[model samples]
Target: MAGTVAATLLVVVAAYRFRSSRQDRSLPARAALPGNVNQQLSGYTFTRSEGGRRIFTVRAVRTVALKQGGTTELEDVVVDVFGREGDRHDVLRTGLAEYNPQSGNFSSRGSVEIELNADPPPGGSNGRQPAYLETSNVTFRQQGSLVVSDAPVRFRAGPVSGSALGMTYATKDGWVELEKDVRVELQPAAQNVTLAAHDPKSTIPFKATAGPGLEAGVVWLTAQRLRYDKDSREVALRGPVELTQGNRRIVAGRGTVFLDSRNRLTEMLLEDGVHGFETTDNSSMSSAERAALRASPSSEPALAHSTQSGPPAHGTESVPWLPGSEVQRERGPLPEALEASAQRARGIFDPASGQLRKLVAEGGFQADSRRGGGDRKQPSVSRLEAEQFEMTFEGVHSEPRSGVASGNVRLSVNSSATSVAPKAVRGGRPPEAKTARATVKVQPATQTETMTAAEMTFDFRAVGRSLKRAQTVGAGKL
Candidate 1:
C-alpha cells in the first residue's frame, strides 16, 4: 500500500510538471487562435526514463489547456510505474485530474485506484495476489513528494484489508500516516493441526508435543491513528488500540509493530494501560491489566516482570480468611478457572509452532483459581500474591506444567466439605449398603490453609488442570 501510494504520487507530480511546462512554453503562439482553452490534445502519452531505462509512463485519453487560468485538465488518466529492471510495476488510474502550472499543484477530482504487483520475496511462493488501494480527493504538494487525502481510503494486500479516514504519504521519506479511525483485518494462513489432549494414564502430566497444524484464524485491529516509518520498518498504532483473534483480545494505549526486510510482521510491542483477556470455557473469562505483549518471529514472544524473591517485612503477618458457609456456597457458581492482574504481565510464545510458552506477571501480582467440583471431592479456591508470578506451558496440548510465585509470596487454599465413604457390613447377609445406619455422614466444615514464603513452586497433575504438588522455599511459614 505504501509503495503504491508513493509511486502514484510521484508519477502524478511528474506528469503534471512535465505536461504543463511543455504546454505553457508553447502557449504564446496559440494565444490569438483560442477561446478559454489554448489547445486540446487527444491520446496524450508521457514517459520518464533514467539511465536509458524507462521508469514510468503517464497517459491520458484527452487533455485541455485552460488558457486564461494557466491550468490543464485531464480525463481518463493512467500512470504506470516500473520497478528496478522492470521486474515489478504498479498501475494508477483516475477519471479526472487537474494541474495548476503556476503553483505546481496536482489534484484529482474523482476516485483514484491503484494496483501494485511485485516479485515474490525470498522463500515465498511464486504466485501472489496484487495489492490494491482506492481513495478520493488526493492532492500533491509542488515542492516535495508529499500526497494527502482528506477523504476515506481503503487498502487491500493479500488477505489483509484496512481503511482510514484520511491519509498522507511522503515518497521522499518513505513515511505514511493514517489520520484517524484506522482499522485493519488480516486472515492468517491456515494450519491443519489439532491440539493433543492430556494422557489419562501417563504419570507425567501435560507433555509437550508438536501437534497438528491449527486452522486459519482472523486478526482484527483498530486504533485512533497509525503511522509507518520505512527507515525503521515499524508501524506505530496510537491511542486506544485494540487487537482481537479468536476468543483472545488485547487492548492498549499504544502499540508498535516491527516488520522484517520482506515486509512481514516479525515483532510487536504494546504498552500503556494494557489489558488482555481470553475466554476459556463456559461463560467465564480471564483478564490481566497493565500488561505488555512482545512477539517476534525469531524468538518466543515474552511477557516481562519485575523480580521479587523474599519474605514479607517483619511487621506484616496477618492473613484474612473466608467463612465456611460462604466458601461452601461459593463453590456452586465458581468453576475451575484462573484469574490474574498485575502492574505488569509478559508472555512468550513459540514462533514456529504458535504455542504459548510462558507467562509472567510482576509488580504487585495476584493470581486466583478455583478447582472444579467435578474434579475433586472437595471444591477449593487458591490464591497467590507476590511480586511476580510465572506459569509455564508444555507438550502438544499446551497444558500448563508448572508455576512459580516469588517475592513476599503468600498462598491461600480454601476447601469446602469432604466426602466420607460408607462402612461395609460385618455380616454378609446381602450387604445392607443403603441401610439408614450404614449411610455415610455429611461433614459440614471448611479448611483454610495459608502459607508465606520467599518463593513457591507448583507442579501440575496429569490433566494439567489440578495441582499435584506445591512447595515453598526460604523463610517460610505454613
Candidate 2:
C-alpha cells in the first residue's frame, strides 16, 4: 500500500511539474558570463525535460553588480532540476575539462555545472537553503544507469572549502551516489571534528527510510563505499570503522562505536577475525601501553559469575549473590623485611565464596606454619615457590546490581629467604651467623613474586540491557 501511494505521488508531482513551459535558455559558450541575459534568461520551466534525458535547466535572474564599474550582470542560477532526468539517463553534472574560448565550457559537452547564491529572505523565510556548483563527467545509457566521473571532479563551494572526485546522480532513482574515494574536510568549529579527503559524495543514510516523515539534522556519509547513520552526539561508522584518540586508536571490521561529544571513543565491538587476532600498531599509544591494552567493553565494569580458579569459563557461574564487594587481605605483621616480602608472596586469603564476590591474589596454594615447642623462642616461616599463580575477582551487589569485575587475585610464586636467626641469652651477646642470599622460584619455573595473569575477568549486567561477561586467559609471563 505504501509503495502504491509513493508511486502515485511521484506520478502526480511529475505531471504537475510539466504543466507549464515558461521559456528556454540559449547560453552560448563564452570566457565570462554573458553581460546581457534579459533576452537569454527567459528559459524558465515548471517541468523536467521532454524525455527523461535532460538533467536540469537554469533560469537566470538579471541583476547589477557593484563591482566592475557598476555594470549590469547576468546571474544564471539554475533554480531547480529534474532528479529523475539524471537518474534515468545516468547523466553526470561535471565541470570544464579544458577551457574552450568559443562556447561556454559545459552543456555543449553533455556535462553541466550548477551554481546558486541567493540572499536569505526577510524574517529568515527564504526557501533557498545553501547551494554550490557541481561539476563531473557522466555516461548515461537506457539499459544501464548513468555513471558520472571518469576522472576526479571538484566543488568550489566558496573560498575556504571544496569537494572533489564526486559521483553520479540518477534522475530515474533520484539517487545521488558518492564515490568510495570521496573525502571532505570541514572547517574546524567549536565542537566539530573536521575532516579532509578527495572525491567525496554524500547522501542521507538509508535508516531514515525506516522512520516516519524522515527527521532532519542528518549529514549522511558514504565512504569506502559504505553508509553511515550519524548525528551530533555520535558518528556511526557503519562499515569498517577506525578512530584515533590521543594515545589509543581502535579499528573494527564491523561494529557500532560510541564516542563522547568531544569525539572520544567510549566503547566498541571487538571481534576476532579468521586468524583470531587483529594486529594494530597505533601511532598514538606507546609500545608498552599498546601491548598491554585490552578491549573496551560495550559498556563498563560489571562483576562476572562466581568463579573458582578464575572467572567461570563461559556461564552464569561468574555472577555471585552480591556484586562488587571484594575481599582484600589486611597487609601486616612479621620481621620487617620478611613481613614485607611475605606480603609480596602472600600466604593467606579468604577462600572463594559463592555469596561474596571476591577478587584477590594468592601467593601459594598451601602454607604450613608450626608453633614452637617452647624450647625454641622464635617464630619460623618456610618459603616454597610455585610456577604459576591464579587470581580471581567478581562482582556481587547487595544493592541488587552487579556485573563482571576484575576479581580477587590468587597467585603463588617461588621464593627463598634466611632460615633462622640465632638468639642470645638475656643480657648476653648472641652468636654471630653468616648469611647468604635466599633464592626461590615457583614450581613450573614460570612463577615470580609478580605474576602476570593470563587474563582477569568479571561478569556484570551491561548497558542495563543484557549480560556482560569477560575473561582474559594468557597474556604475559607470570
Candidate 3:
C-alpha cells in the first residue's frame, strides 16, 4: 500500500509539471521545431522545489508530440519524490508514459515499478529490502486525486508481501483499496523497515508470529477485497477473510487490523461469525510420555476423585479434562488444543513487545477443549459458554493467566472414571483409595459436572505445563 501511495505521489507530481510546462513559461524552454511536423525533444528534465529544497524531479530520455490528440509521450521516464524532511527517497520508473493537459489525465503505457523509502541508513540495507511495487496500465484522474489500475498488482514491504487483481488510491482522502482476490503473506522477522512518508524513527520494531504454537511458521491471509486507511492506520478485509499459520487457523466474515505510526500491530478485530483453533507444541505428546511427566517425583500431588454421592467443591474440585489436562493424573496431562467460536472476536497487542496482551470474544461465545491420551471411547471434555469472554496473557511465552465470562456463563466438564479399590481397608470404614492407580473394584462409568452463573471470573494457576485450578466469582454454583 505504501508503494502504491508513492506511485500516486509520482503521478500527481508528473501531471502538475506537464500542465505547468504547457501554460507557464518559467520552466525550461522546449526545443524549436517545424510547425508542420510533430515536435520532438530529448533529455527532458523538470524539478519542483519548495522552501529552497528540491521536492521532486522528473526526467525522460525522449519526448514526442502525439498528432491525433494534444498528448505528450515520455520514454524512459523516472520520477523521484524527496520527502519533506529530506529523509525519504521514493522513485517511480516506467518505460513509457502519456499525459494530456487538456483532459487532466495521466497514464503509463508500459509496466511501472515503484520503490518507496529506498534510502538506506548510513550502514546500508543490512540484508533487508525496501518496499517495492509492480503494476501496469495505471491511470490517474487529476481532478479527483484518484489513481486506478485495472491490471494485476504485486508488492513487497519488509516482511509483508501480497498480490491483488486491481487497486485504487484516493490521495486526497488518504486511503488505498485493493480491488479483488487479495492475498497477503507475512514472514517472521523484526520488521523495522521504513514505509512511505513515515520517518525511519517512526518505524516500530515488529516481530511477526501467528500464535503460540505457530511461532516458527509464516502467516497467510486471503480475502476478496482489502482497504487501507492512512489516517487511521487500519487495514480492513472483506468477503470471508481467512488467516492461517501452521496448524492454527482463524476465519471470519470481515476483519480489521490497526497499526501505530511505527507499524506496530496494536489490535485486530474480527466480526460476523468468527472461529479459531489453536494447538500447542504438546499437542503431539504421547499418552505414556504425558503420564510419566505428571508422575515424576518433582510434580505436585494429583487431585483425587470421589466415588461418593456428593459432587466436588466449587472451583476446587479437579475436573478431568482433555487436550490440556487429563480426567486422571494417571491418564496424563492432555495435549494442548483450543477451539473457540463467536459472533465477534478482538485481540489486543503490546505495541513495544509485539505480543498478544488480551483476547476478547462476544455474542454466543463458546470454547471447547479436551485432553489427549484418555480412553479412546469416552474422552474427557471441558466446555465454556457465555455472552462474552475475555482472556489476559502474560510473559514472553504468551501464557494465559486469567479469564472472565459474563452474561449467562456456563461451564461443563465431563470425564470417564474407572472404579478402583484401596490396597487396605480401615476398621469397618470403606476401603480408602490412595492413588489413581489403585486396583479396579467396580464398573467404569461417566462423571459430569456443570456450573452456571451470571458472571464468572477464573484465576488460572500453572501446574507444570498444565492448567491447574480456576477460582470462579459472581456466585457461580455447581
Candidate 4:
C-alpha cells in the first residue's frame, strides 16, 4: 500500500509539471517560411521591463500562420519571460524568434510585424514616463532588416512613415535607422517641415515622411542642421540655413523660423553669417560665386555677435526666419546673384561658367537709428560670394515699413576717410581735427566686384550722406 501511494504521488507531480510547462512555453510566430528562418510574424505585441538585481517581467502576444513545404503551422503564441540584465531585452526577443528547432537561421519573409514597449527599468523612483515604440505591418526581411510601407512609427511626440526601406531596427528597444533615399516630413509643434537627408541617422521615436504639395508648414528652409521642438513649436538651425520660396534660395549660418498661430514659417533670424539670395530669374549666370569650400571652411574671426559656435543650439520659442518671404523672379545686379551656395573641391576661375554655389540669407534685423544708422532706414542684408570674397547686399533696398528694410542694400563708405574725437587726445588737451584724424580704407578684391571691409567700427552717426562725408579721402588704383 505504501509503495503504491508513493507511485501515485510521483505521477501527479509529473502531470502538473508537464501541464504547466506546456501552457507557458513561448514560440516565435511566422507568416511564411521556406526552409530557412524566413520568419514572418504579425499581430504580435511585446512588452519588457527590468528592475534591480532581478529582471521582473517580459511578455509577448502574437499569432503566426505560415506554409512550410506543404503543411501549415498556425499558432497563437504568448511569451512570458524573465531576464537577469546580463542579457538585454532585445537578445531575448531575438532569441525567441530563433527558437525553431528545425531552422538554423531566420531569413526571407512574406511579412513580419512586431510591436515593442519598454518601461523605465525599475530600480529607483519611477515617476518619469517610459518611451513607447510602435510599428505595424512591417515586412521584416532578415533579423536586423525590415521593409515596410505606409506603416507609421513614432517615439516621443514625433512620428514618420511612408514606403520605408533599409531600416535596420530592433522593435524590442526603441530604435529606427534611416539610410539611403531618405525623405522625412516632420510636423512638430508649430511648423510642418520636410527634410531630405541623403544619409540620416535618427533615433527620434516617431517620424513621418510627407509627399510633395503637402504643405508641411512653411515652404522649407534648409541647412546642414534643421531641428524643431514639438513641445515649444520652435525651429532652429546652424550652418548653411537656406530658405526656398518659389525658386529663390536664401542662405545663412544660424537662424530661426517662428510658426504663427496659423502654423506658418513666420519671423526669421539670420545670425553670424551673410545671406545669399537667388532669383527664379536665373536669367543665366552673369557672375557665379566661385566659392571653393575647401576641406576647412572656417568662419571669419568672431564679430561682437559671434559667440555661439561649435555647440548644439537649442530652439527658441519663436525667432525670425532668415529667408522670410523671398522675392520671386526679382531683378538684381547679376541674374545669378544668390544668398549662399556650396563650393566643391576645385576652385572657380570664371564664375560665369564655373561650378558656382553660394548661400543667401534675408531676414529683418534691428538697425539702431540713433547710432546703428543715421536715419538711413536700414535694409535687410544679402550676401554673395566668390573665391576669397563675401559680397554683401545683392541690390539696393526700397524704403520698407519695418524700418528694417528688405529688397537689397545701400551703404556709404569713403575710400580713405578719417575721424578724430576729443577723447583721443593724449593729455585731455583738444587736438586739431585734421591732425588727430584716423582713416577708413575700403579695398576691392582682384577677381570679384566686392569691396572688402577691414571690419572697422565707425561712429558715423553724425557723418554725412555721400561717399565724401567728413574728411578728405585718398583714391586707390583699382
Candidate 5:
C-alpha cells in the first residue's frame, strides 16, 4: 500500500511542474527588448556626406537609443558643420542632446555653444574673427538645416557683442535672425569722419570735433528685432528702433541696413515717424524727420532725402533754423550749424568715402539761420520757408556750392530793434499842445519778404568764416 501511494505522489508532482511550464510559455511578450538590441555606443561619431564630400560631423562621448521610442540621447555632444569647400566652419557643442532619427530633429537638453568661422572673401579683410554664440534650449532640423532657440542668446563677433531674446539660424541659406529685443554695441576699428558742408572756393574748414555727449568710434543699435540674410547681404531692423553713431541719434519706427559683399554697411533706409538729431558746434542741434540716408559709390559720403506732401499750412509750428531767443524759448538750444526741415528730405553721399555731397528737402520746406548772430545790428534770426529747399556740396572737400528754395517762398528777418523816426516834430510840436505831450516810441519789428515763383536759387560764397555772398534769383516781393 505505501509503494503505491509514493508513486502516485511523484506522478502528481510531475503533473504540477508541467502545468507551471505551460503557463510561463503563454505569458505576454516583454515590453522592453534586451540592452544589446538598443545599440548603446561610447565615443560615437557620425558624418554626413554630400557629393562624396563630408558636410557635417557629430561626435558624442556616449550615445544611447531608447527602447520604447526610437530616440537617441547623446552626452557631451559636438557637431561641426562645414561650408562650401570647407571654407566656412561652424561648431556646436552641448552637454546633452536628444535626437529623433526618424524625424531628423535634434535638440539640446541644456545650453549650447556655437562658433562660426568664415574665410574672408577675396580683397576683404584678412583678419576676420570668428563669431561665437551661447544659447539655451536649441532645436535643430537636420533636413532643413535650421536651428532655433526661443531662449535668450548672447553673441560676439570681433568688436561687436549683443544679446537677443530669441534667434534662428538657417545653415543652408546663411540666414540669421534675432527675433526680439535685439541690442548691439560695436567698437569700430576706425573713426568714420565726415566733412560738414563748407564753401568750396575757400580752404577746408577745421574738422569739427565731437561734442561732450558723443563717443568716438562707438555705435549702439537697439531694435525690436533684427534679421540678417547672408544670401542677400542685408540686415533689417524692426519697429521702435534707435541707432547712435558718435553724437548722432536716429529713432525710427523701422529701418534696414544694406551690406556689400564684404559685409560693409552700404545703405540704410529709415521709415515711419523717423527722427534724427545731432549736436553741432556750440549749443546748437540739428534734427530732421521723414528722411532717407544712402551711401553712394562715388567720392560723396552719403545722401539724405526727405519728402512731404501738401502745401505749408498757415500758422504751422516752424522748425527752428538756429539757436536764438525765440528758438531757445520754444525748442531749446539750437544747433550752431545749419538746420533744416521739410516734408521730404534727400541726401547725396559719396559711397567710397561716406561724404555728404548734397541734401534736398522738399514739400513745404523751411530753413532757419542764426549764423550771423554776433552782430546785434543784423537780424538775430533769418527764416526761409518754401515748397522745396536744396543745398549742394561740391569738390572733394564737400563744400557748400549753392542752395535753392522754390514755390511760395517766404523770407523773414527778425531784428532786435527797428528805427522809427518820431512823427513830424515841427508840425507835431504845435499839435502836441492839444494832446498831452507828443510821445516818440520805437518798437522792434519783424520784416518779412515773400516770393512767389516756380523756382529760386541762391549762390553762396565764403568770406573769412562767414557766408560772403548770397545771390538770389526769383520774381517776387522782397
Candidate 6:
C-alpha cells in the first residue's frame, strides 16, 4: 500500500508526458510531417502548469515514430511530479515506454523506478533512506487515471519493505490492490524524527535511529492478497494471514490495518479464526493452573507444615512457588510459552510508542499451555476457555500486565506426577502396648482439577509475567 501511492503518482507523470507531446505537435499523426518517413527526435522536454504554478515536467532523451498514426517509442524518460510544491518532489525514471494516443494508454517497456520524499526536509531526510518503488512492464490508462502491472512490484520506505505479484492502482478512486502473494517486512526504523521532529538546542539535529512506534525488532506479514483504500486510510489483507514478530506469531483468515493521516499505524483487526502462539524453548500453560499452583500451596496447611514441602524460597529466585519441595519437583517448571485462539481479535496500538496497548478476542476464545521442562518426571498441561478474552500491556517491552476472561469460563489443570503421601510417625512402644495409639494411614492419589465460572480476571507479575492474583465473578465450582 505504501508503494502503491508512489506508483500512482508516476502514472500521472506518464499521462502528462503524452499530453504535453500532443500539445507540442510532436506526436506523429496520419497526416504527413516535415521529417523523413522514419522520423526520430531527441532532447524532448515538456512542462505542464496550472494557475501559474508548475505541476510536472517530463523529459525524454530519444523518441521514434513506429508508424504513421500508430505508437510512439520513447527512451530515457524522467518525470518530476509537483515540482512547484517545493515540499514534495517525487521523481520517476524509466528506461523505455510506449504511448498510444488513440487508446489513451501509456505502457512501460522496461523497469520503472519512483523515488518518494526525494527532497529532504529542513534538517534533512532525518538520516532516513528515501522511499522507493520499482516494477516492470506497467500500463497507465489515462482515461481512467489507473496504473496496472502483471509483473512483480517491490517497494521500501523507511523501515518497511514488501513485494507483491501484481498491482493495480486507481488514482481517481484513491485505492491500490495487490493481486496475490503479498509479503511485507518491517524492521525498526526512525520515522517522525526525520519528517516531523527537530532539535531546538542544536543547529543540526542528531541522527535519528529510534523507531516510529514498533519495537526494535523485525516483523513480517504474508497474505494472499492486499488492498489499500487511501480515502478510508485502511489496508485490508486477504488471508490466510500470517504475522511473525520475534518469538510471537499470529495467523488469521483476514486482517485489516488502520493508519492515521500521517501514514502512521494505529490499529490492526484480525478476524475469522484467529490463532497466536509463542515459539520458544519453554513450555506453555494456562494462567488458571499457574494461579492455583501459586495460591493453593500457601492456603493448604498440610502442605505448608509438611516436611516434604518444596525448597525454601530465595530472594534471588525470579519465579517463586510455595508448594512442598516434593510437590514442586512433581509439578516441574512454570510454563513460559502461551497459545491462544479465537474467532476474532483486535489489537489497539499506542500511537506514540508504536506498541500494542490492548488486545481483545471474542467468540469462543481459548488459551492453553503445557510444561515439559524441569525436574518433574512428567509434563503438566493447563487450559482456559471462555467466550471472550481481553488483555492490556504495559512497559517498553509491551509486556502483558493484566487479562480478563468472561462468559462461561472454564479452567483446568492436569499434573502428570505421582502423588506423595505424608509419612506416618511411630513411637517406640506403639506396637505392643494397648495404651499407645495407632498412627493413621493415608492413601496416595493423583487427580486433575477443574474450575468453572462466569468471569475471571488475572493480574500478572511485572518481571516474569506470571500470575500474581486471580479473582472470579459468579458462582464457581471446582
> What TM-score number comes out for model 6?
0.64
Runs in model 1 deviating more than 4 A are 1-35, 42-62, 78-92, 114-131, 192-216, 283-478
At residue 238, candidate 3 shows an lDDT of: 98
- Model 2 shows how many backbone clashes? 89
Each model's lDDT: 0.61, 0.30, 0.66, 0.31, 0.60, 0.66
Candidate 3 lDDT by residue in tens digits, 259-315? 876555789999998977654444345665444333311122222122322223332
Clashes of each: 15, 89, 8, 41, 32, 8
TM-score of each: 0.57, 0.30, 0.64, 0.31, 0.57, 0.64
How high is the lDDT of residue 71 in model 3? 80
The superposed Cα distance between candidate 3 and the true structure at residue 125, in angstroms, equals: 16
Prediction RMSDs, each to the true structure: 17.8, 22.5, 17.2, 19.3, 13.6, 17.7
In model 3, state the lDDT of residue 110: 74
| Two-way TM-score contest, 4 vs 5, winner | 5
> How would you encode candidate 4's per-residue C-alpha lDDT over 345-424 as one tens digit per residue?
11111112111122222333212111111111122232322232221211111011111112222223222222323334
lDDT of 1 by residue, 296-377 (tens): 1111121111112122233221111111233334334323345455655555655444445687776787766655443123
Off by over 4 Å in 6: 1-38, 42-62, 78-92, 115-131, 189-216, 280-335, 372-376, 420-446
Query: What RMSD value applies to candidate 6?
Result: 17.7
**How does residue 153 of candidate 6 score in lDDT?**
81
How accurate locally is residue 167 in candidate 2, as Cα lDDT from 0 to 100?
Answer: 53
Candidate 2 accuracy as lDDT: 0.30
Which whole-number lDDT from 0 to 100 does residue 23 have in model 1? 94
